[model samples]
Target: MPNTQRLLTARNIWMATVRPNGTPHLVPIWFIWINERIYICTAPESIKARNLRANPNVSVSLEDGNNPLVVECTAKLLDKPFPDEVVRLFKSKFDWNILTDDEYGALFEFTPVKWLLG
Candidate 1:
């Protein structure tokens, strides 16, 4: 089983995406790991969202520097009327509802392809 405690309890994760010019854009954001996939919500016009639109490849790492957990993944933008489970998880974890908010741009699902933990 995945390390549920470590993953879900993490306060923040650093998400890195590739810019159109081949540079990297990284930011700290709230996330939830469910079913082996990482889910993050942000404005569609955000830099990370724009970058993901151009290139789906992404890297995510927990905030802890002493004992780090990183993963490489591809991001997929979820369509309107977001998944029920995703919304529920976000609510329980973050107490925020992405579905009822106009501030949230879109929900992005990141599927891990590789991991680096120490």
Candidate 2:
């Protein structure tokens, strides 16, 4: 597998969340890794955001098909006035300012509880 830190720099990671009725909601989205925690921004009304409100348990996987890295995490919705470091990371990685983006108003912080690497 690629270096964990390097893999995190990839443009998109697939996230899986559970719907209220028990089905899975999965999508590929931009993310940042800071201090071993994963952070993603999405629209407040997005499906993933709604699902996360109902259930915080989530699964995230890097895009590599041959050598995969998956993380099992418990996610939390971050309050406004987001951290400066998180803002900087997103700016440098995506060239988009999270603080200025109204479309992506909600931020989710994912803390890894278990990791699967192969």
Candidate 3:
């Protein structure tokens, strides 16, 4: 297991999704790390969302290029009415209320299966 302290303190993470054609699509995103899992918000129609729907395998890493902490995870989209605790964490960490935003798309919960800290 990765050091929870380090993972939680990181400001940003890079999420990697596989395109339909097998290319890697990566983007920086805001995330909440709780209970050893990572939660991220993205548009339902966005490329990352679409890619994850097609393939659940994903990789996330801290933005520190000098000392990378990478994790391999499986992502699943949560149905309507996301967990209240998750919503609260997002609000507290990002100061963004996902619950009240109609523009926000889907919320994805990622469970880590592997870790690589360098």
Candidate 4:
């Protein structure tokens, strides 16, 4: 098996959440992997954020098709004054500060419940 950390360094990841009507909403998003959790920042009114507020269940996957890595997680909305480590990592990886960003202010932390790595 390949290193999970290496897979996570990809520029973007595909995340899927269930809408209120039980339909799937999927999009590619920038994310940071910390410890064993996935962290994301998006607009509060975005479809993904709204869906997660109603239903915390979510799925995320690396974009590479040859070596697939998928994870099922429960989403948690993080309050302002986000963790220092998370902020630093985001700056290092994406060079954007979520705290000062108005559009992508809504932050989420996803805890993996299952993993499918092939």
Model 2 Cα lDDT, one tens digit per residue, 33-116: 988789999999999999998999999998988778898999999998999999999999899899999999999999989887
CA RMSD of all predictions = 1.5, 1.7, 1.1, 1.5
Model 4 stretches astray by more than 4 angstroms: none
Model 4 / residue 29 / CA error / Å: 0.2
1-118: candidate 4 lDDT, tens digit per residue: 3357754577788999999999999999999988778899999999999999999999999988888888889999999789999999899998999889999899999998888674
Clash pairs of candidate 1? none
* Model 3 agreement with the true structure over 17-87: per-residue lDDT tens digits: 99999999999998998887899998889999999999999999988888778999999999978988999
Model 1, span 23-96: residue lDDT tens:
99999999988888899999889999999988999999998888888888999999988888889988999899
Clashes of each: 0, 0, 0, 0
How far residue 52's Cα lies from its native spot in candidate 4, in Å, is 0.4
Against the correct fold, how does model 2 do in TM-score? 0.94
Global CA lDDT of candidate 2, please?
Answer: 0.90
Question: Worst lDDT window (10 residues) for model 3?
Answer: 1-10
Overall local distance difference test of candidate 1 = 0.88
State the TM-score for model 1.
0.93
In angstroms, the error of model 3 at 74 is 0.3
Q: Tell me the lDDT of candidate 4.
A: 0.90
